[model samples]
Structure formats: C-alpha cells, structure tokens
Target chain A: MSSKEVFRPTCIIGLGLIGGSLLRDVAARGATVYGFNRSTSGVRAAIKEGFDVSDDLVATLQRAAADEALIVIAVPMHAVGDILDAIKEHAPNCGFTDVVSVKAEVLRLVKDRGLEAHYVGSHPMAGTADSGWNHSHTGLFKQAAWAIAFDYAVENEDPGKFWIEVFTDVTKLIQLAGAEAIPVEVANHDAAVARVSHLPHVLAEALAVVGDNGGILAQSLAASSFKDGTRVAGTSPALVRQMCETNSAALVDVLDEALILLADARDNLAADPADISYLADAGYRARTRLNARSGAHKNSVSPVKISSRPVLRLKPGAYGWVSTLKQAESLGGRIEVY
Target chain B: MSSKEVFRPTCIIGLGLIGGSLLRDVAARGATVYGFNRSTSGVRAAIKEGFDVSDDLVATLQRAAADEALIVIAVPMHAVGDILDAIKEHAPNCGFTDVVSVKAEVLRLVKDRGLEAHYVGSHPMAGTADSGWNHSHTGLFKQAAWAIAFDYAVENEDPGKFWIEVFTDVTKLIQLAGAEAIPVEVANHDAAVARVSHLPHVLAEALAVVGDNGGILAQSLAASSFKDGTRVAGTSPALVRQMCETNSAALVDVLDEALILLADARDNLAADPADISYLADAGYRARTRLNARSGAHKNSVSPVKISSRPVLRLKPGAYGWVSTLKQAESLGGRIEVY
Candidate 1:
C-alpha cells in the first residue's frame, strides 16, 4: 500500500439530490471528487459548476480506476445493481459503498457476486420531500444517521482488521458531515426503518385519500394541521410503495397493529363518545413522554458535572432571599424554600 | 319591540379555550360577556383577568335573562346537554347558541327539550393545541369558519327573521373575530370535519405512536423531516379524542378509506419494487401541486401568475440578457429576442 493517502480520489455515481450533495461535501473537504450522470445536461451543468464529471460511464470509471479511488454508488435503490455491475466491469479494484435506504436484497446481491471484499452497505437517513440536483444542498446530511454495514469476511479471509479501519475512517467522515454512524444487522435496520420510515409513508398516503373523495375543496380547507398530519402522504407514492414492498412483512405487521389501535378507539367511542377521552389520554401520555425524553438529549451545549451543597432554606418573607436564590440557581444549584 | 338598544348580557358557559377566546373577543367589541365555570379557581382567574365571570351557573343565566341577552354554551361535547338544560330552567326567554365542534346530537337534544326556538348550533372551526383561558386570544377566530345552524319553524311562524337577524349579527362579530360564516347542515358539517379535522387527529396520534416506538436513539436522529411529519401528533390528545369520539362513524369511514389506499400502494410496491420512479414522481407532483395551490385562497397573498407570452426571444451571445430578463419578469412581463 502506498502512503499517498489512497482515499484522495473519490467517485460519486449519479448527480441527483443525494449524489450531488455528497459530491459537494466531499469536494468541499479537499477531495478530488468525480461525478457520473446519465443525463448529458446534468453532467454538463456539474462540470460547469467545477466538478470533475462525465456523461460517459466507461470514461468516468476508467479515470476513477487510474486514480485508485473509492466509489460511492448514490443512485436510486432500484438502479443499485446496474451501478454495481458497471463498477465491477470498469473499476474492479475500487472500494465501494452505497447510500441506499433498503439493504437486505442489495447486500445479498453484492455478496453473491463475490464483490463482498470491497463493498459496504450504507443508508444515510437524511432528506427533504424535495428531489433533483437543483434542490440539493451540501448541508443535507447535518446531524443525520448513516447506518454502515460491515461484514467480518472478505474473500473467506479475516482481512486482519482492514475492514474495521475503513469503516472507522468512514464513520469519522460521516460525523464530519454531521451524521452519526449506526451499525446494525441489515435485517434489523430494514425492520426498524419499516416501522418509522415506511409505515408513516403508507399511512400519510392513505390519509391523503380522504381528500380524493372530498375533491379539492376538502384539500383547500386543510390547514397546517392537515398538511403536517399528512406530510408523509405527499411523499413519492412510488417510493412509499417500494418501501412497503421491500419490507412487506414487517410493515404489514406494524400497519396491522396501528389499525387495531384505531379500530378499538373507534369501537369504544361508538359505545360512548366520551370514552374518546381514554384514547386522548393515551396519546397525550405517549407524546409527553416522547417530548420529555427527546428534550433531555437535545442540549447542544456540552454537559458539565459539578458538586455543590445547599447552605440554606429561605422563607418567602426572608430578607435578601430573592437575590440569594437567583444567585444560587444561576450557578446550577437546586433551591428549596421552607 | 323596544326602540332603545338593549345591551344583551351574554353568558358564556365553560371558560376554557374557545369560550374564553369568545369572551375576550366579545368584551373587547363592547359586549357584556359574562363567563361561567364549574371550577371556582377558573372563575376566580377569569375575574382576576378583568372578566365578568361567576362560578354560579344560575346567577350567570339570570344576569343574561335580566338583560334579554343570549347564552353561549362553550363547554366540551359531553357537557353541552347538561349546560343547555340548566340554561333552559334559569333563562328560558334568552336566545342561546353553542360553540361545540359536533352539533347534530346536541341540536337534537336542544329541539327535544323545546329549546330549539331559543337555541342555534354553531361550530367555529378554529383553535390551537393549547387549552385554558390563559391561552385565549381575541384574534384567535380571525379567518376561520363558523358554521351556524338555523330552524325553519321559528322563521316561518313570525316571518320576522329574528333568528336570522341575530345570527347575521353574530356572524359579523365572528368575522370581526377573524372567521368566516359557512352555513352548513349539521350532518354535512360533521362529515366535512371528519375528512379535514378529525382525520388529522387520528394521523397525529399514529405518528406519536411511531415516535414512541422509535425510542431515544431514533428520536435523537429525528430531524426536521420527522418534526414536520409529526408536528400535529403533539396536539392535546384529550381534545383530539373528543373530536374522534364525537364524530366516530365519519372518522372511521375516512380511516378505513385511508388504510385501503395505503394497502393498495403497499401491494403495488410489493409487486414491483424496481419501479421507485413512480413514487418519486408522485411526491414531486403532490409537492408541486401543493406549492402552486397553497396561496390561491382569498385570505392568502395572491400568487404571481407567469405569462406564456414570448414577447422577446433571447439570442445567443447576448451580454447581460439574463439579468435583463430577470428584471423584466419581476415586473410582470416576459423578455424574448426575435
């Protein structure tokens, strides 16, 4: 291995929102980043914007191989296999990873093709409802979670901690992009995402259908409440469908449970409308707990530990009590009045 | 009929969010708005806030009757019938109305007790997640819809249109409070609300459930996308459940329809996971439609309509053409070169 920092040359395949954003981030961090896009105009625009880009996949891959680069397949989920094939044919020695949301099938494909030695499965959970390169921003990955999958075997060998070193470096880079690296089994990741990500998409789309029967009038009267409620519904129906299909069993299970909960509430309400109070109490308690727990971790300021002793208790009418209490509290001390 | 303008001392039952807001709006507009509360502390707080309030319902009703005023019941759905019965006993001659979301059942109750001649059903489709009198704002109802229900018998007998006159006046006050008068059948109103209002509550609760399951790690990684997606889920569950219970059948219908749509999408995706393009396309289309249609209402700022006229066609190698075109477009015209 040469000491010239083999990670310097990086290739990003695709120039859509996610791909474009990653390219910009990598380039901004002093990496020589090259981009490949099927769209001639996209390639032209990226080049004009000072990126090393090419519309020709073969030419782009040849240049990447010459540089001994790492390649990131940032295409849509369905296009992942084709991109991998292209990488194998053109730049076979390059280390490869992807930023696809779904993993089980894709990881299986990589392993079966004897490409497991260089491939890692990654899912960077960051996006807006917006799409396209035009909507891309370098700050998109800020404070996001990037799940990176690493396997112990490489060509039926231990690889002697080489995979760990690569993953650690990748994790550090992800952290610099303001994302945390979470390691989990591909199946577990899919199930977890099916619950939080895919299920909401399906539910949101389903809720949006209410407007379909009511016509545009119903949708027009929809305030921020309805918009926020069905925001995920406005997500790409195709993507939502893909997510549901990819993680069908787990998504179906979650959906079934949600439906049961809703149905039970409806039945109880029919029996006695006031019984809706119980559902509301349950929801309130759940939301309050979520908010409190989330808030506890949200202090951006670094935590500091201090040891202190309470010296006195002041009565309401005690002289100099207000000033003393304020001073003590300001120093992060707990105060109680007797 | 008396020629002297009589000050109608209004009794607002249940001094909570809506009732308190109405009291503030009416009082500020020079109407004598008297509030009643079951909680003595609530009554005391209202009085402390300079409101004419009482813990005694009978006293408040008597005060309104003495001034030949209207009684506005502003309690939760379950409490409306009892409050109306109390008002009938103490202030039978005074006109009455209510500010409850669901109305058909309550309207039936009012008519069954022969109080329909004095009572009208009103549902103001406006509120915040926060409750209590302290959260009341006089401008809360501005630009919202207030549905007013009228009876044909009273208008046909006297032909004086007294109820209509009072309702029109109240509607004007509602308009002043920043709401529009939407005359609707109580059943139709409930159905419409089920689609637009009640359904959102169910969706919010569902989102809260997703957040709950995601736990601390998931919540920590939850960004603006998650926040926006679940914003409505943070609304008071009790109020939401009240809405759901009161309009259970309609909500259940909507929920069922929503689930079916979701199921269909899920199945479609399961059949073809490779077609994620459709999902992205649907999302793009929905977002585009939302953006285009958002400000098309009367209350919102009118969107700038782009003209299709190619007044001046741009020629190649035209220096400063882009800037000139931008300026021309900003001034509501197009620029092109022949």
Candidate 2:
C-alpha cells in the first residue's frame, strides 16, 4: 500500500475471464478490490485464490457504494444493461466503467439508465480465447492497450472538472492493471474495434469452417498458417457472437469490405489465373502501414498523459480534446496516469 | 550413422527457408545432403554452418545423378519448371521430388517434362513467415506433416514397383527430417491445400488490409486476435502470390466459399441483431469436427505405409490404394517410416 495516496478501490461485477483477471491484477497491485459473479464456481474459485469475491451482486455494489469505489462491469455486451440497472439501484452515485469489447452499445445502455454522468467507457484489449474464472490470471493486461472513452466538445462549464476526475480514476485503474489507457471517442470505438477485433473472430470462424470442408486429407495437411489464422475460432462462441451482435453495424461494414476484397481476388484469379497480384499488393501495402506505426510512434511525441499540454486550461468551455485524442492515437502512445 | 542403412542421399535445389532447413535437418540425421542455391549468401551461410552447399545447380545435379540421390526441388512454384528442365538434363536417371506447396501444378510440370516416372510430388508443410537462408534453422520440419503424392488408380503395370520405391525413398527422406510423410493423391492435394494452406494466406492478408483500414486508433488497438489472424500476411508476398497463382482454381473455389460464409453472416446481422447465431453455430460445429478427427485417429488402424496392406499383391494392375490413403488421411495420423 505504498501507493495508498493514489489508490482507487475497484469493484468488478462479473467474475468471468476478464473480470476475475482484473480483480487479481488490481489486488496484486496493492489496491483493494471486490468482485461478484452469478456463478458459484467463479466466486468459489476467486475466494479459493484468496481474493475478495462474492456471489451476491447487490451486496458487492453496496460495498462499492460505501467505499466510493469505481465500479467496473465486466459482463458480456448483452448483460451490460442488467448490470448497469443493478449498479444504478445499489451504487447510484459511484462513477463506473466497463471492460466490454464494444463501447457504443454500453454507452447507450448507460444513457438509457440515466447513468452516463457517472459512467466512463473502457475496454482492455486482452484475454485469451478461453473464458470463465478458472482461466483468469494476473498480468493478462501487461503491455496491452486499454481504450478509455473521451467526450466531445462540451457546451457548458470549464471542460467539466468532474469528468476529468472520472477519466483520471479510470486511467489509474487501467495503469494498475498493467496497460496503457488510450483516450478515444466513445462513439468511434465500436467502429475501430469492429474492424480489428470483432471481424477477426468472424474471419477465424469462417476459416475454420472452410478448413473442415476440406475433408480428411486437408485436415491432416493443416499446418501453422491455418492454425494461426483460425486461432480465435476456438474462443467461446457465445462470447464472440455477443460481441459481433453488439457491434453489428460496424462489423457489417468491415465484413462487407473483407468479402469484397476476397471476391475480387477470387474473381480476378478465376478469370486470369495470375491476378493474385491484387490481394498481394493490397496486403503488402497494409502490412507496410502496420510496420510504419511502430516507427512513427518512436519519433513522435509520447502521450503518456494526453492532458499534459495546456489544452485543458486554455479552453473557454469545451477543449480541443478531439485533436488531442487523435494525436495520441496516431502516435500510438500509452496514456500513463502518473 | 546409427541408421546409415536406411540413409538416402539428398540434393536440394534452392536454399530458401524450406530448402535450407531441409539441408540442415537431413544432414543432422547423418544423411549425405548437397544443396544448391542461386544466392551466394545462402551457400555461404550453409558452408559456414558446416553443411555441404554449392551455387552450381548443374554440378549439384550431376553429383546427385552420380550417387543416385533423391533430388529435391525446393524452390517456388514458378521456378519448378526450370528446375525440372535442369534436372532432366543433368540428373535424368535420378528420382526426384519437390517441397512445393502446390502438388498438382508440379505434377503437371513433371508430366510435361516426361519426368513423371522419376518425379515424386511432395510438400513439406513447414517453415515460418520468414524466407531465405539466414532465417532457416535446424529441425524446422520437426513433427510437421509432409504430403507425398500418390498416383490415381494406376494402369498398365503391377502398381509400379519403381513408384513404390520412389515413395519409400521420399517418405524415408521426410522421416529423416523429423516429419511424418502422409501419402496423398496428387490431384486432390491442390484442392486440399487450397483450403488449409493457400486460402489461409489470402485470408490473413485480407485481415491485415482491413486492420490497416481501421486507421490509427484501430491499429493501436490491434491485439493478439488480430495479430494471429493476420500473421501470415507478413510472409514474402512474391512467394504467397506465386503459390496462390499456381493453385488459382482450387484457391478460387475455397476463397469464394469463405466470402459466401462471411457475406451471409454480414447479411444476417444486418437483417437481425440476433442472427449472429448462424455463424456461431456453424463455427462451433466445425470446431467440433476438427476435434473429433483427433479422437477418431486414436481409434483407427495407423497407416505408416499405405502399401503395408495386402492390396498391392492382390491387384491385377491397379491397386486399391485410394481406400488406404483415404483411411490414413481421414484418421489424421502421420505415416511413420520403420
């Protein structure tokens, strides 16, 4: 507890892989944590591991309310609404965040429940294909990027001091969990994750199906490439399905784009037999961009704390935070709370 | 030298990753191997590592012919025809095979050169995304599957005793390299690899392109799933392109199927939020099938050598090898060499 001065008590409502891991990570960082899950197995596993865990949702929220802890909903997207309702009933004034993969849907749910004022959206881009408490472990978020929500230009007071503290709390929590919290526009998060995260699951599953269709000889021949390409297909289907459904619009757009690219490659090859150049070129260019990001970040300003600049103080009402978030994102720097 | 009685002298034409690694493995297995490379650096690296390598393809082939060695053409598909022509000139009496990814195209090329009688189609399903001699290492094909082509219901001979020895030579080479040589139909190899290998490359590249399209935020947020899905996109594009082009027909078929699956998932999602169930169900079932194959293999008879059965003796001319290969492939077991 050497860092007691900046310590933020954390309460997680879902002891699945993400939730249980978050609980372990926070506790291991010398911070107080309480976790709840509907499943007896998850609670039992957490308690057996010597972590503070409970099966009663309302009791955990009540404890979080008493300690003024930041409540983190670690349930699947479909379960977010119910979790938010429970938090609102038991921990009405506690500032909250979530570890949901898709953000916009959870944002809407918070808005619907009149809990937006006390809510901060965040997603830890970590975890294995496996789920449940038994699979959870510490250091899951080590060196990973955590996307924390940023608001648009405000119409009212001095950039909303309350919201800044909420962000600070969330980022601090993320830091303790061993990740770089990157500030991002909440509305845009679903679209971005849909392309990079959601679509991959779908693609892996499709690859899996196609490999199976190759029959016996093909199955025996599947090597490292196929294994890597379909690695995510082994993930919990219900989990993947829920995430894609929550971000359906953006996932559809990106899935359509992927389908178009594949079709074009297939058609071109079918017609000319040597037209694989299309996909090969596009893919090479894309890989170059991916490589470039690593180098660009090395030369650019590191945005450990994006607000380190004078943007917050110079603002009349709303700050130019959009530009700041965009800059941090472009630089691919982690936002450090300290 | 412990098992020198079964040793097969190896001559490899091409010192790329696969070829270089094969030289290292075979030599480590106490077999005499001579490797030829177009690049001076490859030959230099192998020589520095105490491997017998040279830059003169003609001289290497001549040596192979003198020793009656098993010549291995381990270059790209587009380079195979030229290598076959060279082998026809200098090693006309030597039996040869290839480590090419596509079997049908190489089979056609060998047939065109009238070298089919002395040529065996083989593909070592190994190597990393990297290429060239520097990236090669020993035991690269350890425990990997190597596919050797079997002719379809042969006619006008007693199952071709020479071909059987050719297969035994190829399988022994694979075994010495620490791999399982799976005998498969040459014509079906292309279609099978198209689904399990070639199409995975295409899909990985497409995923990489889509991830790059997600912009800076998405790029920063790309996690293990995206990385795994797009891992093969980092491969040498020229190599991937050539492999796809060589098997364009089979690739097109499988690629089209993947597109249809993804498009159907997209359309279903667009129509109904709950429609993600289609892909989830199909993917789960496919994964189950993949898992089932492992168990099925454990229960069935193992086929280390397909000709181990009495069918070779019972056949008047054409052997019932199809059923044997099918059983081996279906069970998903590696064909061991005794």
Candidate 3:
C-alpha cells in the first residue's frame, strides 16, 4: 500500500477490441499481461498473435489474484457483472477496474458485490466502426481521453496513503496505455458521453434504415455527406445493442431531446420553408465552434484557448481576404495572411 | 438542331460551389463559360480567380441567349423560379437547365413559365460540407452521379432528332464536367434524393443541436464517431433549410419514417434494455451491404455487383483463418493465405 506499490501483472477478461488493445499495450509496457475470453476463437486469436491468453476464466482470475493484480473487465456492460462475480470468488484480493461505456451502472454493481473499495471505473473515448481482436491495435488508445469515473465508495472508504497510491497507479497505467486520464463523476461521464457517443449511434441507425428503404437509387446517390453521417451504422450490431442497452437511461433521454430539436426544425420547415436558416445557422456555428475549440485544445486537457494563431498564405490582393480576416477575428484567431 | 450541334458557351447563374466548379471544369474543356452571381463579392472572387464573371445577370443572360447557349441555374431551390423568370424574360430562346436539389417543383415552374422545351432538370449528387466559391474545386463532380431528370415537356413536344441531339449535348456537357449523366423521372429523383440527401441533413442538424446543448463536456468527448456522424451538420444552414423546405414533401415523409424507426428502437431499449440487436443487426447489414455494393460497382452506374473479389494475405496457422475465409466467401470474395 506504499507509494512505491508496483503495478502487478494485469488480467484482462473478454478479448474484444478494447480488451485486446489493452493487453497489447500493457504487456508492451513491461507489465505481464494475462488475458481470458469466453469464446475459444478469441483466445486462439490472441495466442496466434503472440500473446499469452487463456480460455479458462477462473484459472486466469486465481493466478491474477495470487499476484494482487489489477483485473480489468473489458467486456460489454451487461457482461461485466459476471466477470466481477468470478473475480470476487476466485481472485478475492485483486484490485479491479473496467473499460465499459456506462460507468454509473458498473460502479453501482461493484458496490452491490461489496468490491467497490478495490475497483475503479474507466471508459476510453476511442473506437472504430469495426470491432474484435483483428481490428484492435496497440495504438488505439494514443491521444484518446480515458475517462476515470470517481467512485463514491473509494471516497467514503478510509483515506489512507495506500488507497491514494493505488488510485494513482491505476491512473499511471491508463496513461501508460497512451491516453489522457480524465477524472469525472460517474453520472456526469454517462450523461456527457450519451450526448456525444450514444445519441449519434441511434441517429446513424435510423439514417441507415431510411437509406435501406430507398433501395438502389438511394445507394447510388448517397455521397460524402450521407456516408459520413452514418459511418457508425456499419458497426457490429451486438456492440451497438450492448452500448444502448447499458446506457439506456442517459441515451434515451438524449435521444428524446434530439428528436424534439429535429421535430421543431421539421415543423418550422413545414410552416415556412424559405428562411429556415435560423436552425441551420445555429447548427453550423455550434459545430464549427466545437471543431475550432477541438483544434485549439487538442493536446492539452485544459479549456480551449480564447485565441489561436494560424498561419495563412494570401496572394496579392486575395479576394475575400478582408472577410477571412474578419472571420478569424470573430473566432479569436490571429491570422497572418501574408 | 442537327446531330452535329456543338455545345455553345455556358452561362451559369449563381456562382457558388457547384456553379464555380462546373465553370472551371467546363471552361477547361474548351467551352467558353460566363458566370453571374447576385452578390458582387461572389462575382469579384470568380473574376479574380481568372474566370469571366459579372454581377449583371441580364447582360450575361442576353449574351448567352444570343449564342443559343445553355444556361445553368445553380442556385438554391427556392431561388430557382426567380432565375427562371429572368432567363425567360431576358434569354427567351436559350436552352436552359437547373441544378436544384428538388426537381419536380423546378420542372413544374419551368412548365409554368412556358419554357418547358428550353429547360432540363439535374441534381448532381456531389457536395462538401463547406460551400461557396472559396471551397469550390475543379474535381468536385468527378466520378459523381449527375441525375438528369427527364423533362416531360420535351417528351410531349416531339421525339425529334433535334430534341434528342440537344439532350445528348447536355449529357455530354455533364460528362465533360466529370460526372455520369443519370436520366431519372423528376418524381423518382425527388423521392430518392430525399432519403439519401435531405434526411441526413435534418438528422445531422439535430445531432449538432444536441451537441450544442451538452456544451463543453460534449465537445471534448466528441470523437471520430460523433464527428463523422455529424459532419454534414457544419454545412450551410441556408442550404439545408432550402433543401428541406423545397423538398418538404419527400423530406418530411422520410423524416417521419426515420423517427418511427428510432422511436421503435428507443421503446425496445426501454422495454428490455438487455437486447436490441434486431434493429442494430438490420442496420449493420444494410450499411455493410451498401458499402460493399458501393465498392463493387464503384466504376459503373449499373446496379451494384452482387458479388465481389477482395485480395487478402494470411500467415500460416493463423487462428480463425478458416472463419476469415468463410466470411470472404460469403461476402463474394476470395482469400489466399501465404
């Protein structure tokens, strides 16, 4: 429990994209990484890829517990509880964390199983439309935000140096995996991610339905706009279902809000179609602001800069240079149009 | 009009992205191009970029009419009637077509103005989220589908050689602009593009609204998925409003259907919150099918290839190699492992 408490060999259950990625990264960091997956193919895939993995879950847990290891359940949200139960039974003394989309529910379940003090919750905001071990890469977590949900049980437990070091080591491990560790309350994390992540999945799914109904003509005419707007629709159905089901409360709420906004725009178009730029303007401004802000604060976790400096090359008497300068000023960017 | 009718200079009114890109491409094909825009700055920008552009709409139309040139109205949908009226008044004998998203209304307006024989309808399914002349490029329409709505008036007037040659010339011009000329009925064009184009815009705008509501936290967590899912949200609001407003009938219908699909998914999630893969699987299959179809027939306008061949390389004793081969076969591809 000292400040010098070393990170033990890690046990990662469920060797999907996130699990496989974590195993590859953690093992490369000089920490022994043991992996387990229920599906025989998942284990074989990892083993074939030159990793140490096993299909026997209980044995992996017992071995991990003997080393006081950090057991990470990298399964779907619904599958996390069963893994926790197995960990409690076979790896009773092991500290644990999880890489699930829904943080509040997992944290609550950990508390229900009386394992809160030994558990932390993390969610990486990094993924692709593809899933599984083959799609997983060691660099998946690089430059991504790994959200660490502040567990209530840990706050309520004895405030000792050991607990502090344990939590700090977990954060260090997350950083070692090539992501920024962001501390957030579980409720806030779920709600915020619902807006950014889950809501888009729902909308993309619905968009795909419309495209499917339109048949050949729709497919032929679908361009960059439609393709990008529904890129997530091509993802694995089980993963999409798991994410929505586990984060149902926040997701449904956000979906309802989004529908209301869309309905309002639709009704406005229905009423007076000519000047519907109000909604469009609002959307353009908001999206661009987010993009500019994202560009401005890409490396640092701090708030976005009030001003940015971007270099631009302008020819002699460049048309629209004045407007471009004005726009840069409005966005709080200094443009040196030479 | 003989079969040897040469393509005369094209006078394009509304020098935006589509118009500017067309102007650059058409002029590069050795056909003279005259551009006109209502805004003085737009004309100035085009002229500065070494194109013949003027702010005087009447002068451009008169000159084009004298050459019996084809005038392309490349403005927003709502602005089409005004331009049509101007063309009819100033360039009465000029052959005309429009590049509006909604075809039926524009065609009806052409008939209303008694210029049916002089007008054709087209909607090029190519655009970027960024609009205006600044973002326009010569290759915007390259490999894109340029849907030419078959005009009913021309069909009713006469199935003569001259009319056929005129239509052929227009199609050749569209090809010269680096796009495939797809002849479709106006009604069919409207309905199909509604599902593929307009519906995605509405959904993207709504997702952007939700992001705007979530503020900084949502913006920070917005990753590649959310970014791609809402890329269209940053497009010009005026354009989105116009497309939705002018094509309200089809857009509203598709929007309603999308909402129903989304609501069903939401209700199912709320009801069980355990398994909603039915909807997800359907969406995944549809999207993948579209992607594979897109890849298969990417070069032809014909219905997408029912099967495809994709090359793959596998190492010896690769785990799941058999399954990978099976998947390739199912997807109409052959695999070779060396």
Candidate 4:
C-alpha cells in the first residue's frame, strides 16, 4: 500500500443497495470491509450476501474508531443526521464520507457537528429501481460518475498529513471501483443533482399523474417513449418522499424553471406553430450535446471487415465490383480486396 | 387464403422507417409490396433493401390501381395532403390507410378530398431514432399497438361488404405483422396519442432545455435518469417539429395539465415537505398500473422446482439433514429426498 492509503478497516453503515454494493466491491478490491444497518433484517440480509454486518451501532463504531478506519454513511437523507450523531459520540476522529443524493445539507450538518476535519461528502450518480441489500450488486458504481465534495472548512484549514492521506485514499478507492471521480463543491453538487436527478423524478411523477387523467385509451396506447420517460416514477414512495423533503430547495429551483419552460412551449405552440423552435432548438442542442458527452450514439453500426478472397468470389464485372464496394461503404465498412 | 383476405399488391407510400418496415415484413409474409419515395436516394435505398421502389408517383399509383391494392400513406403530417391528393387523382377506388401520428387532421383532410369511402386513418405507434429507408427493420411494429380510426362519414352510412372486407384484411395484416390492432375513433386516437406520445416528446424537449440552463456541472452529473427521460429528444428536429405542429391542439391540452401539475408539485414540496403524497400517490398508482398493464414487473422472481431423489447417500445425523434442507430452501429450491 502507498503512504497516502493508510486508512484501513473500512466500515460501511446502512447496507442498502449502495452501501452493500460498496462493501462487495471494496472487499473484492482487498479492503477490510465491515457493515452495520439500523434494521436487524437489513443486517441479516447483508450477512446472507457473504458480508460481515452488525445491528449494534456502538460496537461498529468502536472497531472503526480504534483502527482509524474510514466510515461511509450510505443511509437516506433523513437518517444521515442520526448516523452522524452516533459517529460524533463514538468515532468523531475517524475518517468519514457519505453517499446521500444531496450534499450541501450534509456538509452543513457535518460542519455543525464539528466533524469537518475528517469528513468528505460524496454522491454517486448511480442506482436502479430495485432497493435493499438483496438487490445490490458489486458492479453498481461501475462506469458511473462519483461526485466528491470536500468540506469547505476543512479545505481552507491546514489539516494534518493524516487527514490528507485519508481524503486521498477515499478518492483512490472510488476510482478503483471503476467510477469516474468528479470533484465538485458541496453547493454546486447539490444544484447539479437537483437539475439532473431530482427535477426528473418530480417531472416524471407529474407526467404520470397527468397521463393517468387521459383515460383508458391513453393507457392502452402508451408506447416506449412514455414508458422510458416515466420509468423513475416507479421508484419507492418512501425513497421519493425522503429525496423530495431533503432536497426540496434545489429541486424547487429546477421545478420552477421547468414549469415556466413548459408553459412557454405551450404558448409558442399556439403562437408560431410553423417555428416552435423555442422548444426544438434547445432540445436538439441539449440532446446532441449529451449524446456527444456520453458517446451513446458513437459507432452504433460497427464496420465489417472483408478479405481479398471474398472480393475474388464476386462476379468479374465492373458494375458488380463497383456496386459491391459501394454497398460495403454504405454498411460502414471497407473491402480491401487488392 | 380466406374469401375476405383477398387484398393484394400492397402499395406503401413514402418509404421511410414505418413504410419500409411494413414493405419488408408484408413482403416476407407473401404479399406483393411496392413502394414509392419522394426522394431519389430514398428510392435507391429501398431498392438496395430488395424493395421495388419508384420515384414516379403516377406510375406507382397506376400499378396499384391496376391491381386494386391497399395503399398506405406513410408520410410525414405535412406531406400527407400531397399523397392524399395523388391518391385521389390516380387511385380513387382503392382501399386506403395512413400511418401518420395525427389522425383527426388526416381524417379531416381525407374528408375534404372526398375520399371517405376508401379511407381509414391508421397510426402505428412504433419507430426508432434513426429514420430513412436505410435505417428500417422488419420487426419495427412487433408487439406494438397499431391504432386504427375508421372514417366517421363511412361509419354513419351502410358501408358495403367490400369495405368491411377491406377493413378485415387490414386488421389481419396488422395482426400478421405481430401488432395489436386497436380500433378507435379519430378524435379519441388523436387525444390519446397526444397524451401518451406527443406530450412526452414535448416534455422531454422542455426538460433538456431546462437542464441545459444548469450549465456544465449539470451536464456532467446528468446520468441514466436524464438520458432515459430525454431519449426521444434525440429525435430529428424536423420530425419533432411536424408532430408538434400537426398535433398541437391535443398536445396543448396535455401541456397545460402537466404545467399545473408540475407547479403544484413544486408548491407541495415546500408546503407539505413531510408527505407530498398528493403527487407521489397518483404517480405510484399510475406507475404500478402501467407496469401491470405491460406485464413489465410480472414474475420478477421465479420459484425453483425440485424432483424427488434418493437420500441414501446422506449420513443419518439430524444436524446434517436439517442443514441440507435449509441450504436447499435458501437456494430457492426444496429438498426432495425420498
């Protein structure tokens, strides 16, 4: 192990999908992993998945505190404060991080608790509709962007080498788990997530409610587009409620903007049907920019390689050869028949 | 073939994705399919796909007229009128249907052209992002619902046996191509598509525009939810423009409702931060209802089956037997030891 990566005996609290996934992957990557869950059933479920977990919070903390371990709090937004309180009483000096959807609020809570010196706030832009430890997989964070928000107070302060090493090790673990580490400020992270994640959830719920009013005909005729657009609305109500309550500030900002944009689109539809470019232009630009950013549409049609022997099998005519070569080019391939 | 299944020489106009898909699938199913395209390159592409396509509209019409074919107008909304005009001039007595998104407008245009006796408004709720004849596939309409709207004028009158036979044959063809034929009135079909299809497209466009306002951080943080929510936004601007313009009336209704619902959700997020069930309740119900309707969430976990086997190989200890039985049950199977 490197000098920077001395934060061992990694402990993950609340073994839901995210925490369980991290436990599996981090353990697989040679970290000494332990877990604790608030519910007995959750702890048992994690144990069934071949993970070491406990329902006892103090014992879980004491082990981490004595070992100078890194503790990842992966509970929902409402439960984060309780976990932080537990940490403050038992393991305040231990390295701590969190994976809640919101960041600014979490940082604030951590600052208020005076855990800033050993704290980092993180939110992984990843999940599936399924929840619980049973639904978690080791590859949950693979290829997803993991946002890391360092505590602003700690950032400006001259923290000792131990804290710096702990922060560096946490980043290394995230990258090792095959996620792109995107370092962002707590406020910026929350704002970005509100626009991208929380707004979509709210909009999807709204779309579903409005669609339900369209009667049986609309229900029967709903196709792939409708299905994809509202897929996130099928998430658990408790989870959705927690997210909405905790991140209401940033979510309300995006929701207000979306409502105005949607209303203007309706107005534009009536005013200038010929050029409803107000919606189309930005939509097209944003969509294309996202596609380019994600490389979603790149090289969908792969090239087919052909050898000279295959070309020789063609009929000995200029039209046949020219047409064959043109066909190959159209199919996104080249026939190198020398 | 049955007596009522006598329609032949299926003529498909504007050989884009829908028309080309129909041409390929119907031809494979033993129908003589001929195609016409407005563009030379489209005709060439169709020909490359082993379709008999022509850029000559009048000649294509004469061929259909000679064979008494069922002509399908599969063009964009703006071009529907031009094709209907050509159909009126060239093949007035033939069985006709259109695969446009907007049915009410098409029915009105067909009535205005005085071709009610030979027309049926049809919209196949199927497509991909990639358009044109080259991007077409045979299974585009597989398991999709094809909405069919009969002419109200012809419906009020006692349409002859021949018209009924034509409608039956069309439904049979749709079924044969692996799609459910949903018989709906013109107005109902338009309103339904607006709610399920057009409204989602508009909402997706609006979301992309709003997310774009969040700058680079929002773009970077945007993940699967954003991608799925805006999948249809990546559609061609020209196509989106036509759908918005032609179906603006129905779309405007849903847009207005969505705006109010979204604004209310935003308000509720602030006012009733504890529950927000006004939005979440309906969203949950609608999502679950859709999932049940589509058989999407059905059979998520399968039960294991076990056959009776000899237990002679096992040691006669109670602990071993109990442990073996428990282990079997945990693996989603039963211990069937004889």
Per-candidate DockQ versus the true complex? Answer: 0.20, 0.57, 0.32, 0.29
How do all the candidates rank in terms of TM-score, highest first? 2, 4, 3, 1
Candidate 4 recovers a fraction of native contacts equal to 0.72
Write candidate 4's Cα lDDT for A94-188 as tens digits.
88889888887788898888877788777788997678888888888875777766444235544555555566656666766666556666777
Q: What TM-score would you give candidate 4 relative to the actual structure?
A: 0.85
Per-residue lDDT over B1-338 for candidate 2, one digit per residue giving the tens place of the 0 to 100 score = 23554476889899899988888888777678888999998788789888888999889999998888888898888888899999999989888889988888788889898887787788888978889999888888876788877673343244466666666788788878877777777767789999999999999889899989887778888888988888788887898888898898888889889888988898888985447887777877786676665554445577542321111111212345455555565555456433
- For every candidate, what share of the true interface contacts is present? 0.33, 0.78, 0.64, 0.72
Q: Report clash pairs, candidate 3.
A: none
Question: How far in Å is the alpha carbon of A300 misplaced in model 1?
Answer: 6.9
Model 3 ranges with Cα > 4 A deviation = A1-8, A28-31, A153-162, A272-278, A297-338, B1-7, B153-162, B272-275, B297-338
In model 2, which regions exceed 4 Å deviation? A1-6, A152-159, A295-323, B1-6, B152-156, B291-323
Which has the better lDDT: candidate 1, or candidate 4?
4
On lDDT, who's better, 1 or 2? 2
Worst 10 residues of 1 chain B by lDDT: B329-338
Q: Pick the candidate with the highest DockQ.
A: 2
Worst 10 residues of 1 chain A by lDDT: A304-313
DockQ of 1: 0.20
Candidate 4: deviation at residue B63, Å?
A: 0.2
Model 1 misplacement above 4 A: A1-9, A27-32, A44-52, A151-161, A269-281, A297-338, B1-11, B23-34, B40-56, B66-71, B150-160, B210-230, B262-293, B297-338
